[model samples]
Target: MADEQIEVLVVGAGQAGIAMSEHLTAAGVEHLVLERDRVAERWRSWRWDSLVANGPAWHDRFPGMEFTVDPDAFASKEQVADYLAAYAQKFDAPIRTGIEVHSVRKNDGRPGFHVETSTGTIDARYLVSATGAFQKPIIPPVVPADAGLHQIHSSGYHNPQQLPDGNVLIVGAGSSGVQIADELRRSGREVYLAVGPHDRPPRSYRGRDFCWWLGVLGKWDMAAPPVGAEHVTIAVSGAHGGHTVDFRALAADGITLLGRAEGVDGDVMRFADDLRTNIAAGDANYLSMLDEADEYIARNGLDLPEEPDARILGADPACMTDPVRELDLSAAGITSIVWATGFANDYDWLQVDAFDENGKPRHQRGVSSEPGVYFLGLPWLSRRGSSFIWGVWHDAKYLADQIAIQRSYQAYDAPALAAH
Candidate 1:
């Protein structure tokens, strides 16, 4: 491969890319972010028109920009996308888009790396695969490929207008599944949400949105690692993965929650019996935590502007929804099954051999096995909140410092210390 040399190269220009760019620039580390598409292309393209961000706007915002919407309110996908575009501009991040990375190959003898892209090749001493995790859609192998069911992943969905009429079955009980189920039902489509283990909390409980406290107590950073907590955190590529999205509201809205999908044929999904138990456990966990939160507030005299009446659900459901259900994709003329099933991260372009068998890079708080190469802007990349907007800021600063220190660049070269 033809090559010139550079100090650093970053892949992907989303949140992580932006964060890394800030650090590299501050450290005076020469780096480039290789973006395959327009900045924030996934955010701008994949989201449904009716979809609003699941988290409060502030919690999802990037550095140097304030959340324009109500702190407790949700911003539509468009708004979040626009915010990202603005964030890129604010930092003047050096992101070269429309350059698809073909492969990242380690050099035969050199200590550096090689990046082959749609355009050309570039060599660098450092590579940050900020490609983010939600890389590709995953459909279960169990589902027959021949099944005449409409299947689509969340990444391909834009709005309900694109969906075929009638009932829709959204597989995977993650927040996306629940939210999409909610969206379809509102658009007058009969919806069936297949249930599974989902991590989420209510949008608001006991007069306060969980995020309000997360921001207040700085608990979002509470999960941050004790050291380099900020930079070491992972990125929340999808809101559903790291935080709780209000599933209780999904059930309360009368969305039929089916057990996990057993198999899909002719538009009918067979489900496991465990769905009942799973939902009960989820509700119980939420309620128990809410009770504790309510007590903490009362005991500490915490004041919230508005709190919903909190009630705990019994371990057993008063009535069980039937075990098996079928939504007629053909009858309803439904044309797509949105796999809110989450994304699989792909980083084949990373030339280094530092990745684990699972294809994840082994790093301790964004510090990679490869020296002179560091990563930033990952969800829980280090600490608990490492991926949240509020949580990641600290990580950004810290990781920046680590990179600076590693490079032997002292923060603001000190004037020769005054002689005693």
Candidate 2:
């Protein structure tokens, strides 16, 4: 016999899982949420100490709660974790922390799921995989393993003091990479930042934050990335009360900006010669966003003031002049390397035929093709904001509705079977 049984089971205890629990409870669906660690463990433990929420507090939170900080201010990592915990507590979510799920498979000869956990086994009529998107850190093997340098992924990096005393090379010019590079440089360490394809958006424009403009322009509800393009991380920062991320300013401040890291030959790290090209792409994205916002304002006849300064934050002439193509780590006195190349989905335990060849979940707005299986908290799951806190809440509500509808159908079928 299974150690536990429920009508619905949700795996994970972070924002997505807890949000699922809240919606399930409201729908009167008997469900339990299993968490491997404490509530919002990713926010609480996995992130660096200096990290903050990318969105402003007012916009990033679930609808039911408000942050103690000012609406326009960004929330710290600790504050975000505490907020999620409080949200779960306020609703008395049925969360079982410390229960690690080892595997999940369809139950043969039965219309349900068999879940194997660290504590015991569980059987449920429905399963919602809410483990989130940032599961596994993807660190490329660009640098040799025998380079004899201390290397850590962005997820494992905590603070400047955690690294050895010397110059640092941070690959991947995403938000994490730029932020860490800036931090290290400020701490009196020579930092090398490898630039990559990324969107550069102003933190605020026209007397409002960029997130506010997105919401107003209905950009957050954007269903998908542009055709023939995948989503790229935006180069913005919430550090020091929030500010626009200008690569030119960063370069001027002593952070050596290099092209994308290519490979390593002996002790020399090779970089591409497309630094200017990458910077221009970011600038294009930045200007395009501002143009969209301005068009929206003009069409609506809004009384917002025009901010011309937003358009001027473009490519750095100095960066375009000459970019470093290669660096000898040993000669540069670089003692540490931080790989901020992003994450990959780790659903090896999900023994179901619900994924594409790329190992990505196959779902239509969280509803999987396999019966009684669902996915939540993935980027662009239903819309562009599907992975955000506010977005996850809405997605969870939809999944709960699906579960309730399925239960109703099951109830009808049970009665007819009994009569037969």
Candidate 3:
């Protein structure tokens, strides 16, 4: 590997990296972006072909780059990927694709870091890990081993037709699981979804999108729940055009709600008897979100129509009252399982001690304890929207500001070094 040195190095060419590159370019930071794959590779290959972005295209646009298409419309994965590629090109981001980073460590007693990549090694005074939050797919350790059933994570899911025909068990009630289950059910497959605590928001509330209300309520800017706090997973989808994925709606569509998957014994899967509690928790969070929005409207005194009773909007139907406690995979005719649990951060190559007990990179507002090392595109890094496509720019801009300040200091100290 050829050795070189640079002022700054940004990893990953996704939205976070590109956004950071934009600010760095404007500041003349002299940084290079190293990407393991082509720009937006995750959007292109990691996601399902039929999947669409969760939020509206208008809200998904980055700084100075607007979606020229219908703003209100949901963009498919392909569209989103193409948009990122164009954004990188438009900004002329100094990116080198197909460069897999192996490790990053502090250069002993030096003022920079040693970044080892597939192509070469580079030393950078400032290092930004914009590898994003969803770096690794998490599968439960309790998942049946050698169960003879086809198992795939939601990230690997593409279309309903791809799976073998039979009953499908979706092990998660988050947005991805709910959307995939709905699609499978609509395609004439018997779907059994394992319920989990989540937040259920209507696709459109009153006369505006739920996301717009979230922004208005300042929820996007709000910090994440305290560590280990009981946080509700936000569940919504924009597939086949945006719509709220309600538990009652799924039940009404003949999708069976199974409780949390506890374990697997032989061919039977054990589950908890907590579907009711899960549904109730989700409903409560949904109402709470709406209440927060209403409070915001009242406090702001914006002229708008009176909102309908939230009760009527969030009421649960009798059909969803029952929950399945167990599933005999063979008896139930289940042939496949899709785990939509979530993703974990993959920092195996980061040879730094700046990690929390949970193996997450340790950082405060994108700034790590390691001098000149920073992180971007992490969930709730600075605010609630910090991980989303529309939200990462905020953290990126913040890091850019910090980097610029450091650059100025380095420049100021350069003359002293020469004199010495």
Candidate 4:
């Protein structure tokens, strides 16, 4: 027999899971939210000390909840965690912290799920996997383990003081990589950032924040990127009171820009000769966004202020002029390497066959192909902003409605089954 029984079980206590809990409560669903650690543990522990919410407070918060800070301000990691905790408290969410979910499998003999956790077993009629998309940090094995260098994934990095007193090599120029690189460079460390495919949206466009423009233009509703396009990480940052991530600006500020880190040979790091190409790609994305915003303003006849300077493209950075194809790490005094490569969804504990060949959950929005199973808090799960805080709230509401529908159907079917 299971240790506990629940109508619904949410397997996370972060923003996604908490958001799910809020909706489940409103829908009159008897659900319990399980968290391995404190609520928003990732924000509290995994993220760097200087990290801030990428989006402004007004746009990043859940519905009916206002952040204590200014709407235009970006909340710090600690603040975000506190906000989530307070939000959960306000709703009186049924969340069990420090209760880790071990494994989840369909109940063959029963029409439900058997969830094994650190506490015990929980048989739940419905399961919502709200553990989030970034479950495991993915650090590629490009460098040998015996390289004798202190290597850490982005999630493990806290601040410059945590590393050895030497230069830093940050691989993968996504938001985290660039932000950390910038922070290190500003801290008097020689920072080398490996450039990769990324989108460079301006911090603000024509007196409006980039997120505001996206909302007004309905870009957030985009279901998916164009077909045949490579996955490009967003290169925006809200650190240091927010600013546009200009590679040229970063380069001019003494941070060295290199092509993608391809591999490592004995004490040497090889890089692709595509620094300029990558920079150009990011620039193209930046200009494209501005162009679309401009056209939208023109077509709609809105009185939004125009900033012609936003369209001006700057010259290439000096570092890009003579890109380094290889770097002798030892000679360069590079004592640490921060790999901001990305993350992968770890669903090993999910025994349900709800994933595709690519290991992605097969779902229509949050509803899975397997009955009573759902996924939440994944990028582009239902829309472009599906993983954002506000987006997750909406998605959670939909899932709650679907769960309600399932419960109603079960109620209608139970009596018929009893008759037989």
Best by lDDT: 4
The clash numbers for all candidates, in the given order, read 31, 0, 0, 0
Model 3, 1-420: lDDT tens digits are: 239988889999999999999989988779999999999899998887778888898887786887766888988888988998898899799999999999998888768888888977888888899999788998897666588899999999988988998989999988889889998999999999988777788777666788898787777888876454334577899977798777877887888888889999888798998888888877777788777767777788877676585457434555346555667899999999999989888999988878888887878899997779999998889998886887898789999999888777777743455655
lDDT tens digits by residue: candidate 4, 1-420:
999999999999998999999998887889999999999999999999999999999999999698999999999999999999999999899999998888999998889999999989999999999989889999899988789889999999999999999999999888899999999999999999999888899999888899998998888999997675436888999998899999888888989899999998898899999999988988998999899899999998989888998878777777799899999999999999999999999999898979999988999998998898999998887899997999999899899999998888888844455554
Model 4 deviation from the true structure expressed as Cα RMSD, one decimal place: 1.9
Backbone clashes in model 2, listed as residue pairs = none
TM-score preference between candidates 3 and 4, better one: 4
Q: Which stretches in model 1 have alpha-carbon errors above 4 Å?
A: 1-3, 215-254, 265-268, 305-308, 312-319, 325-335, 409-420
Pairs that collide, model 4 = none
TM-score of 4: 0.97
What's the residue-level lDDT of 291 in candidate 3?
78
User: Which ten residues in a row are the worst by lDDT in model 3?
Assistant: 313-322
lDDT at 145, model 2: 75
lDDT of 4: 0.91
- Candidate with better lDDT, 2 vs 4: 4
* lDDT: worst 10-residue window of model 1: 229-238
On the 0 to 100 scale, the lDDT of residue 165 in model 3 is 82
lDDT (tens digit, per residue) of candidate 1 on 322-408: 555554556655555777777676766565666788977778888888775666666667766665555555666776677667656
For every model shown, what is its TM-score relative to the native structure?
A: 0.83, 0.97, 0.93, 0.97
